[model samples]
Target chain A: MSGFCRLERDRSLATRVDGGGGVMTGALAPIALSLRGVTKRFGAIRALDGVDLEVPRGAVFGLVGPNGAGKTTTFGIACGYVRPDGGTVDLFGEGPFDPSKHRGRVAVLPQDAQLGRDIPLLDQLVYFARLQGLGKQEARSQAGWALELAGVTSRARARSRTLSHGMLKRVAIAQAFIGEAELVLLDEPTSGLDPVQAERIREHIVAQRHDRTVVVSSHNLNEIEAVCDHVAMIDHGRAVLAGTVAAITGKNEEVRITLAEGPVPLDMVKTALAGDSVDWDEASRTLVIRFVSRPGRGAEDVIGQALRTLLGHHARISQVVKGRSLERTYLESS
Target chain B: MIGPTPFRDMLLVAWFELKEMLRTRRALVVIALYLLGGLVASRVFVGVIGRLEDVAADMLQTTRTATPGALTRQVLHSDAYREALVRLFPNRNVADFLLGLPPIVLFFAWSSLAFVPFLIMMTAADTVTQEVQDRGIRFVVIRTGRVEFVLGKYLGQALLMSFVVLLTGFVYLAVAWRGLQGFEFWPTLDGILIFWPRIVVYGFAFVGLAGLCAMNARSAAVARALSFVGLTVSWVLGEMAYRWSDGIFGAAWTAIGFLVPFSHKAALWRPGVAGVLPECAVLVALGLVYLSVGLVMFRRKDL
Candidate 1:
């Protein structure tokens, strides 16, 4: 808690650098993956434009963006599928992206990349494990454990071509969890899954936060918000905003209260809550209160003051949202 | 955490590729065509030898016609066939030894030497590109080093080509058992043995070169076309070098021809292990050089 408080103070003073996505953080956990000034082009189309990202270790970092955003392309460069035309990438501060150097330490589930077509899924996982330097028997055991984590152990002997779309997606995810990788990057891990399965996958992702760094990109904003501790939102190859979930959503800076139809005593509530700025949205009859938070100033304290003032004014409050939802944040920025 | 376990990685990747190719339709078709070509070659060579036997029987006028083996052996054991073998071999003793074997075995050996290179090219052209096009290589290249991945592919295709060439020996045994008059077991087996390893070395040179094409191109069809163009360019360069051997351009043209696989085939035809062994080493060296160049380019290719 103390370390996070100091990190917040340092991040506030850090300026945005050349890359538009530069949300700075000071000496957090050892960064799991770092990209600096990365640029990429596919013919005349620019896929990525000087994008920079820092993924701290032991966090479920979400790469949130809309359709045709640079999230997948950024993953491509990190995974060495597409060589960046410019800039550098570092994994665990070790070195550049060489497959041998990064072998068992980094695992990636590329978007839409199929597994071995007719090979049994377990054997394919074993092949990947063996290449990562596991012995035959150990590779088999680890591969089985990965399949169980993905809940696909029943189809371990099935060929990839014979599986349904959701089954194959699970198999692909299973491969990423094969070895004892320190960092795992999954692109749309729960894309084709039903609601129940998607929730299970989200739990699996969050479970990795204890020992491994996980990075995921997806269109499902609710899942991202539910599972991710930190996030960086990009639009059209530029980082629009990035920070912890609390920081980006202004969870401490703002709270919204929906009041029932009554005499709207907005000025009385504003005067009662002295320095905070309050506004009313007529459509929803919700008060959006923003405050400048400082040390020892808890969000609970600000929310309590606002609630008391509104109750004293005899406003019947129906609902209260703690912060701006991630959906609204994405819509506003995108 | 990577270690100095490149050999282990290569073996694993190679085995995976070998299994993949075993189930590939392109490899199966190429193998079937090579076997069919062996059958056609056996038919054609056996007919030619049969006609020679008839001519010899007429000239000697030994109407004993009861012994087809005797007539065929006597005819091939003549000075005329010895001269023909001499023209094919660089050494006189090598020619004399080859003249003792059956004509169909010799012809089968020659056809495999001529046909196995194309088989390798066709099978290897899609080995890298199809994976790249489908992004399936993302799974592999991330697991193994780029050098090991490319080398694994070459080693996989090389071993499969060697296996396919060995299958030709069985093709010879099958055809000789059914089609020939006197198919001596030991001699026919000996000829097949000599031919298999030699042609495999020839096929090895082209497999690495075709892998070069596959790694450089993005589509399987383009890779196949490039491999054909690579083979054609090598052959045409060698032929042109020889055609102008009497001019001042001969030295440079011959040097250019030396860089390609086509110029190295003549040494493969030399008749014994001592004569052929050095060329086998050279062909392997040439294959490695082609592979080294391809690996440099493949490492730089995006995806």
Candidate 2:
């Protein structure tokens, strides 16, 4: 929703993984982070090959790829951890990163970053808050706020080594949310948590979208599609596709209806659709309608007419879906 | 690129490092061992100096007129000790310097000059590398510059060493009061005062060296190994450079010692404020050089 996909709307989602993944490039919203021609090589193997990406402000952007697709490396470069071998990174349009100018504006939850084992969780967070330029009292208050946000306030006084893996992870996530950060980059925020814990984190992350631009890199595409309105798919160290969830999933171009044991009103439904293509699969008992964009008429109007026609015949409709599944789009893109 | 207030950031990091070290009892353990070792060493000093006086009295045939304490002072100020001191420290009032301080305080200064650098390096070796190895530094460096993190690490180690040095001096002062009769508390305290800052500044140089070693390392164990290796290599090279000074770049070769923190330990023995000022500057400059080199490499390294 926050970024307009630069790719032309069509059926084939196959051509985008070369990190040529494009958004409208500052045309739709203010840019939160932009990486142009960024390339990095570790020894002989290239980690990122001219990867380019753009994250629009206040969008829950997901970076999803297979293992070692340079997701973590990209986060590292954005947060000033890893130095890129080539190209520029523009954070909040504040030029290249200089600690003096860009210190407290960005926060990151690095995948492998572990908090101090012997220090209490709260104290560690307070130290991070202080480094973010808060005074002592404010730092403590902010640290407490972060702990509560992560749902780990009870474990605040517990040492990091004493906590469970999930709790420590929540503490790590807590640190990233402190100090009113404008751009928050989380690399695999729920890498190894249970479904319940993961959903909790997703809910928290979803709540942050109204205020902060959050970029998350995860292996969970369903989780990505669930929480993020925008996504960029990276394959082989380059972003192959980037777009809003609806655009990427083709939500505007088609509608799908799954049927139960009911009347076969295919010709009648076609009459309701009028100009659009409507096909019924007898084996699966489903209706697939393709959108034909006409002057001012949209997919919603077509779906409304089809639904009224089908229901008028006393047909049983099990499920109604807009466009396609994210998994289907991802499989097509990859 | 830097944070808005790098200096304040440095202090924040430094304070946290020290607090963490103390909380974990790493510093406390080291300090306890250092104090225990200094106390044992002080006991040895008392025994050794007392026997040396007896030897001096016997060799000079002064046992008939002088008592034990008088003989020790006489032997300490005698021409033999003076010549030996002068030979050890050239063109200086070595005998007067020896007699001006109580013997226990002198032992602490000399022993600290040789031993504390190692202690400081050991204390500092793990400060950055552990966090770096685990990628925990990413969280901090996101809010602070690499330079500040490194500098703050050094300052934290330096402050910890300062505490250890202070505690050792106080422990030795107590040893003198109880173990050495007629210890002249004022003169002995005065002696500790003179060398306190010297010991602190001397340790600062090594703290910087330790920082240089800790940065760009993969693990804390590796950083620790590098610290000892760096100290040994610097020492060997310093010695070789001094020995080879008669060849080409003789002055430059000798000046190379100024680059290593180990070589400056002797210069602190220089008499008077005027003689010691240059050494302080050199030590401070050496600390900065090592730290700057570490910072340069750390800035470019991928964490």
Candidate 3:
């Protein structure tokens, strides 16, 4: 927990220094949604215990957790579907559940909510749009645009009951994007989708980050890492770790270089980067190098120097990958 | 875009519910069967009354004492019959109207009002429970307030039941008009239409009760069963109260009977529109109370 706090602090500080391009700046962006000391109890089971989260404006935030870790519960609270027993939830600095304050401002794709089985896809979308206060013509137009965005425009006339699970999920995603929602909460958007459809949905989610604040909750760490700029890992109804994806996963400053030939000599690689922590995997022909930049140097400088030295020693590097994966970070943190 | 107001959002939910109800094949089939059953029952009722009236007329002629009209006059002038008419129609002489009409029309009016509420209960039993069980309500709940969702659902069920009641009334009126020789179309129509407001109120009351059951139950089957049980319990209690009205516990039982909707079903048969207003108001109040309680429970419940 202390380690996560340090990372969070560092990420905040880093965001203040580096504005918009490389990593998301939490300090500069306004908080789109904040949950403070939110607690929820279902009978004797505490679904969320003092959970705190801050999703920044225009940032794709991911809520990752194992099953029963309260990700969906948190989503429920944010969408005003579930009332927290204790604590406060603010959306755009107002209570999320207050309809007059937050009605059209927030949209949510609940994890397993099925569309009306007897309603046509287009009618359902149009109805959702109308609920958001769109005029009839505008609602129809927005519904069409949403369907096109979700890549399900061709099946607009199909009844929801006839669509496959993946298609229904896509349509549900489309429904969330209808109207001009400022904040969108998507829970397990790609859970039942195949890899291809999941990838497409991820692309759509990423596309939403430009104008809308997206909070995605899923168990797919890789997808979160791929699409989310900021993430919080929850375990036991508590936020175990949270920050920019890069900061959370790249804190150790480790890089892996896969060689084209047999495992490089560990001694030679160590001699080249004498103070760095290096490990060699003989079977995969991969070398992992961990280093912290000195006052006058940076990570690129260190990696550049190591590469020059390794090449001078006749090492053939095939691929170079930066940072540890989110899976590894999640496993370690939770 | 701005979001809808509470009223607009509730209307949207009601519109959606109406569409869903109309689209449901089973519900449509049930409504059709109810109309058909009303027509068949109307025919059977007219035939039975015709036979009974003939038998009475034959006995009167053989005894050489009186005619059927004189007997009807005697019955209409009786204390129990006049009391019942005054209770239903405080302002008008409904006994005179009933005396002028054939017995079948009077019998059909009472029987239909008594039976339509059950049909409404059956039709609306699963309205909310199906959505709750399917988790379809989650989408609308997020968009609109839970209170709006409940109100919209109740309104939709009420509208559906009203439509079914009117359709059945039309069918019954048509069957009687064609089957009976001297059926005064306007008078019989006026007699049936007098009960329309009360019938609507009664239908809505049953819808509200069923909606209350539906909101609380987890499954459609359970909701149906619970709503049926609720209706049965109300009827049984009301009947018991009426039966015990002469006993020592009569006051208490009557007070308890009024708590259920069944006690007030006869209010629709009153003489004038103004005479039945209080009953309509009572039924509306009961429906609203049931709906309000359901809304509170639904809002607190974990979806």
Q: Cα lDDT for residue B122, model 2? A: 72
Tens-place lDDT per residue, model 3, B1-303, is 323377787788888888888887878888888888888888886665456656776877744222223344456558887678667765556555565555545765676678777787777888877887887777777667777778888788788877777777777788767665555678677666665556888778777788776678979899889988888887899899879977999889988877778888766655667877888888888888888888788887877
Model 2's TM-score against the true structure: 0.89
lDDT by residue (B1-303, candidate 1, tens digit) is 333577777778788888878876667888888878877777666666666767777897856443235567765778887788689776887677677666666777777767777888888887888888877788877777878877888789888888887887777777766666766878888878877888888888888788766678868899989998888887788788767766888788877777777777777656779988887887888888888888888888888
Please, what are the lDDT tens digits per residue for candidate 1 over residues A1-334?
Answer: 1000000111221232211122334563488889888888889888888888999989899998978789999888888778888888888786567765577767888888878776788888899878876667767887777677656777788778887888777767767877666688999988878887787778778877857799999889988999999999977776778889888888888889899988678888788777888999999889998887889876777778878877877878898887899889878877
TM-scores vs. true structure, each candidate: 0.89, 0.89, 0.86
- How good is the docking of model 2, by CAPRI class? medium
Share of true Cα-Cα contacts across chains kept by each model: 0.66, 0.94, 0.61
lDDT for every model?
0.78, 0.80, 0.76
Clashing pairs in 2: A16-A240, A17-A240, A19-A238, A19-A239, A98-B1, A99-B1, A99-B2, A99-B3, A100-B2, A100-B3
Which number leads on lDDT?
A: 2
Clashing pairs in 1: none
User: Interface Cα RMSD for all candidates?
Assistant: 6.8, 6.4, 6.2
Top-DockQ candidate index: 2
> Which regions of candidate 3 fall more than 4 Å away from where they truly are?
A1-29, A262-285, A292-301, B1-4, B53-92, B97-105, B244-254
Ten-residue stretch with the least lDDT total in model 2 chain A? A1-10
Residues B1-303, model 2: lDDT tens digits: 343478888898899888888876666787788889999998777666667667876797866432224455665668897777768765566546766777777789989888897897677888888889888888889887888888887888888888888888988898777666456788888888889888898888888788788777878889999998888888887787767778888888777866877777777875677878888888887887888988888888888
Candidate 3 global CA lDDT score:
0.76
Which whole-number lDDT from 0 to 100 does residue A258 have in model 1? 91
